[model samples]
Target chain A: MDTDLARERILDAAEDLFYARGIQAVGMDAVRDAAGVTLRRMYQLFPSKGDLVEAYLARRDARWLDSLATHVDTVGPTAQARVLAVFDWLEDWFARPDFHGCAFINSFGELAGTSPQVTAAARHHKDAFHAYLHQLTTAAGATAATGAQIALLAEGAMTTAAISGTPAPARHAKAAALNLLTLDARPVASPA
Target chain B: MDTDLARERILDAAEDLFYARGIQAVGMDAVRDAAGVTLRRMYQLFPSKGDLVEAYLARRDARWLDSLATHVDTVGPTAQARVLAVFDWLEDWFARPDFHGCAFINSFGELAGTSPQVTAAARHHKDAFHAYLHQLTTAAGATAATGAQIALLAEGAMTTAAISGTPAPARHAKAAALNLLTLDARPVASPA
Candidate 1:
């Protein structure tokens, strides 16, 4: 296989192993074995275990962000529908057999603060979600503070869904988000 | 020191170390050293690392549940306040210097599906929270399903707050919980 193809295969294997097991639990050797590549070949593609992990997180983050962006584009422009679409996307994710939880979250919990790369990746991914929510809410005509609150609730719901092993958290979060959006009696005062 | 005291010391050390550092990173020898006890003493008090982890989780669980119970009792018997009180307590927790997130949640993420004892303790602790929410909501006059939904959201908010490294998620979750309880028009007909 070409270098790019081999690198992709290695990353795919690493992501699966890291997600299914954990970053600390899965070593370079295991990634090599799973990827059907020799140790030498693995080394050639990725210089260190940390590098492989960074690559894994980057790939996963890209896919997740892209998927969310796609969902937002495909769904209606209304803030409510767009926000709800995020949860709808999550429902599909939670249904997957390998859906252990959020990969970034799982990594953060396992790695703690040891790896700056992993931490940065996780934070970036989360910020991306918040940005999307903020933009969607702004378009839907919410004030800055209210948009932030809605985004926070949506993020909380995602975390709760993963830990509690139930989808109710996400659904309730969506309900709560809708309520927050629609409850304002008067339009948000235009920015000062 | 007495056996009970020594056990507590070991568990306390283990909890601090495990929470700060990942479980796999801390060993029995380290626990013994941190507790100011010998390996023999450590083994006598807790036969295995797993037992020690369980004991640590159990102790933390009891303390958390007790705190929540007290909060609920002090909050004037209103379901909404009781629900919000949980988050209030969490805010206090997240604000602490030693706060690395929920111990049970950190443990659950680390252990994932690995050990039965860990799984059982994690599940039992989570179930206790759910049960408490259910009772509080029922007393506050919410339908059974609404109680469950609120409980799930609260749990989710807590987890999200931990993972995202932001207090806003939990704060937003509390706001959502408040909104759920104070809905002007019964949004969803109270599930009988």
Candidate 2:
């Protein structure tokens, strides 16, 4: 196989195994077998397990954010709606049959102590997520601090849903976010 | 050592290792060495790594809730203050030199997929946490749903602090929870 296709295949396997089983529990050989790639090809493509883990996280981050943004664009008609849409999006994600949790959060828990690369990857992913929420909040005339608070609700929903095996947290967080927006984003009177 | 003393020592070592590092990364022998217990004695107490993990989570759950309640008892004079005090407790916890994150959250992420015991333990911990917040909210005249939402903020702060490596999320969550309390728990007018 060509190098690009081979790399994609290997990463696909890695994402599945690592996310499902925890990163440390899955071996490179397992990834190789699942990807249908030879060990030599896997090494040539990833060079090391660390490299593979980083690539998996990078790809997953992009795809996860892109999917969320795409959903928001489709259903959200106003700035306020856009903010709430994040929780709606989360509810859908939590309902997925194969959903485990936030991969970055899981990876951070599993590897952040021993792996700087994983730590950096997890931080970068969260930073991007927070930045995106900040943009939505800014457009809605909410402070960046409000944006940060909303992000916490989203973060909380992910872990809550993951642990309870339920999507109800998304709805609960949405109500809280709505209450926040109602109070924080109200229009101030114009000066005469 | 007596059986109870040996069990306590083993759990202390297990909690340290499991919290600092991930669960799967640490082995029975490592826990044995850290606890200064012989292998046979270790097995005599825990019998399996699963037993050790469940014990660690169960003990951590009790102590964690006890600590939070104790802090609230000492510093929180009003119902409103008691609710906000949960965040103050979290901020202190996030600043601890040995703090990693919520042990249940980390354990669920690492082992929930493959271990039913860990899954049940995680769910129980969260349920009890939510119930505790419900008590505070009930005392403060808020709905049960509001209690769940507050719990989400606390949950969010945990993962956010763990990933960002900062205690700032605690303060942010506190601000949001305060706003929630101000809106949701207001006084009602008396009928004439």
Candidate 3:
């Protein structure tokens, strides 16, 4: 296989195996087998399991945000609807038969303590997701803080759906996001 | 040591070790050393690692919610304030030096796919948490569904804080929850 093709194949296998099974549970050999790439080729491409894991996450992060953005663009020309589109996308994702929750969330939980690379990847992914929400919220006539709030709801929905095995949390969060976006938030100062 | 005392010591060790290190990273021998209990005694008290994990979660669940409930009761006599109080507890928990994240969340992520016990334990904890929020939300003049929304914020705050290594998500979630509690939710019908 071409180097590029080999690299993509390696990552495709890693994302599937690492996501479905926690990181520590999968061996590098398993990834090689799943990718149908030789050990020498795999190491030549990734150098280390950590490197492969990092690449896996970086690739997933870009693709995840891209998918969300695509969905948002399709569902929204309006900023408010764009924000709602996120949860709609989440609802759809949660319903996928292969859905196992946010890969970043799962990867971080599995590897944060043992791997700095994994931790940084998860943090960066969330920060980018937060920034995306900021843009959407500001466009919807809410402050950046409002976007941060919506980001929390989105994260919560992901975890809740993952654990509860239902997509309902997405809609629940969507309802709350809608309220926060449209409502007068000034008089509602939280005790925090 | 007596069975009751031995059990307590084992749990303390498991909670401390598991929370600091992911569960998969900590072994039975580590738990033994940390707790100062002999290996034989440990197995006698908890037959398997799964049992110990279940005990850790079951105990932690009761204690964690209890601590939050106690703090909420002490700080907020009013119904609406009680709802915000949940976030207050989260902020405090997040600020702790050893704070990792929600035990149930971490445990679920670490073992849910491989262990039915872990999955069931996590689901039950969340259900209980949702119910607790339901009581607080309804008391605060919000519907049970509103409580469910707030539950998502709380869950989001926990994961966001854990990943970002900051307590800010708790306050952000709190602000969102406050808006959700007081807002006219009807006009904010979600696109989903």
Candidate 4:
């Protein structure tokens, strides 16, 4: 296989293991085994386990942000719908059998403050989310304070949904987004 | 120290280590050292590391549930206020320097399918949160479906807040809770 293919294979194996188990629990040996590659080839592809872990998180983060941007763009110009669209996406995402909670948060929890790469990746995702929410809320004609409030609500709803193991968090978030819409006299979409 | 104090010390150390570091990363020796107890005492108090972990989680679960119940009771007869109280509590809890995300969720992420004790604790806490939300929503006169919806929003909010590394999740949850109150024709409380 080409080096590119080998790299992709290693990353795929790492992502599966990391997400399924955790970054800490899975070892380089397991990654090599899962990828059907020799230890020498694994080392050639990535200098260290941390580098592989960083690459895994980076790939996941990019995909998440890309998906978020796409979802926002696909939803019509209505801010409320856009906000709701995000949660709708999350509901589907979490329902999968392999569903774990947010990867960035999980990484942060596992690594604690030990890894700068992990922390930076987690922070980047979070900042991107807040910025996206801010833009959407602002587009909806909410004041800075109101937009902040709406964004905060969206953030909280996501956390609750992950921990509480119920769909209520998403539902409440949609309702809250609708409420924000109504506060500014914008037409609200019916909850799907 | 007395048996009760010894137990408390072990739990305290476990909670500190477990929260500061991943469960898998902290060995029994470290826990023993942190607690200022011998290995024999640690094993004697809790027959296994798994038992210690479960006991630690159980303690946190009880404390959190108690706090939730107290907050619900303290809020006036309005479902909206009761719902808001949940996030209010979360905001306060998360503000603490030691505040990491939910321990149950963290443990679940670490153990995932590998450890039965961790999974059970995570599921138990999750179920309890759902049941509590359901009861509160129902008491607030929401239809069964609406209550479930609100509960989902709450769950999502909590997860997102933890992931996003912003208190916004809890704030968003409060707003969503307020919206639910409006829908249910209950009085809304001031934001915390």
Candidate 2 residues B1-192, lDDT tens each? 899899888999998999998898899999989999898999988878888888899999999999999999996569989999999999999999888888888888888778899989999999999999999988988888888889999999999999999999999999999888766654222322
Interface RMSD of each: 4.4, 3.2, 3.2, 5.2
CA displacement after TM-score superposition, residue B116 of candidate 1 (Å): 3.6
As a TM-score, model 2 comes out at 0.95
Q: Over 4 Å off in model 1, which ranges? A: A185-192, B163-166, B184-192
lDDT of each: 0.73, 0.90, 0.88, 0.73
Which should have the higher TM-score, number 3 or number 4?
3
Q: What fraction of the correct interface contacts does each predicted structure contain?
A: 0.23, 0.68, 0.58, 0.33
* After superposition, candidate 2 runs with Cα above 4 Å error: A187-192, B187-192
* DockQ values per model: 0.30, 0.53, 0.50, 0.34
lDDT of 3 at A42: 94
Best by TM-score: 2
Off by over 4 Å in 4: A71-80, A141-176, A186-192, B71-80, B144-146, B149-169, B186-192
What would you estimate as the lDDT of candidate 4? 0.73
lDDT of 4 by residue, B1-192 (tens): 799999999999999899777788899999999999999999898999889988999998998899878877887777657766777887877676767677876777678647777777887887888788778877777766556555655555555555555665667557656655556564333343
Candidate achieving the largest lDDT = 2
